[model samples]
Target: MEHVRDSFARQKAMTLIGASLASLEAGASEIRLPYRADLTQQKGFVHGGIIGMIADSACGYAAYSLMPASASLVTVEYKINILAPARGSLVARGKVLKSGRTLTVARAEVYADDGTHVASMQQTLMMLPDTPDTPE
Candidate 1:
């Protein structure tokens, strides 16, 4: 949907990491990240933190897709497991596990260019209805 695409496009963090929204549907989304030397570790594989970042956003977007138009969301907590060394490009697929009025649970799996499973994540997100500006 336009709303989802627009929100993803406005995410500066995704742009900083050279990631793109590959596809999205209600309750599901995918992110593609190109491999870059700056994102790798000494082992020449993508760092776990970078992997976690994309997985987190991937799940977050999935949860957001199902939220009401007037609501915005934030990650409450997430657990990610790195399964293999990530090389080349990566694609992360996320799907909502449960959608609630106030909380949503989502999961994601990252795969390497050759389709090697690289990481998995489960996340909890809190949906907040838009409100007037509040003190930060």
Candidate 2:
């Protein structure tokens, strides 16, 4: 949706790192983040923490896309598995599994440009009441 795309465009980190929204439909979103020297760890591989952050952001945005404009969400818990060392570019795809009035559960997968499965993550997001100034 245009709103989602606009919101993503305004995200400084996503913009600065060149993360792009490849696709979005229903309650899912696919994002791509190219690996640059800045994304590398001291050993020259993509940092594990960066991988987790991508997964988290992907899932969070996917979940947010399904909610009513008045509802806001935040990650309450996340579990991630690093299957292999990440190098080069990465793609993250997220999908919403379930959504309730108070919680949403989502899953995401991170893959290397070579199509290797690098990591996977699942997160639980809590819906919070929004004040007038921060309405969703």
Q: Which candidate comes out best when scored by lDDT?
A: 1
Off by over 4 Å in 1: 131-136
Model 2 alpha-carbon miss at residue 59, Å: 0.4
Write down the lDDT of every candidate, Cα atoms only.
0.90, 0.84
Clashing pairs in 1: none
Q: TM-score winner among the candidates? A: 1
Clashes of each: 0, 0
Q: Which digits, one per residue and each the tens of the lDDT, describe model 2 over residues 1-136?
A: 5556666776676777778888888789999999888988999889998888888878978987886655567899999999998989999999999988889999999999999999999999987655211423
TM-scores across all candidates? 0.93, 0.89
- Determine the C-alpha RMSD for candidate 2 after optimal superposition of all C-alphas: 2.3
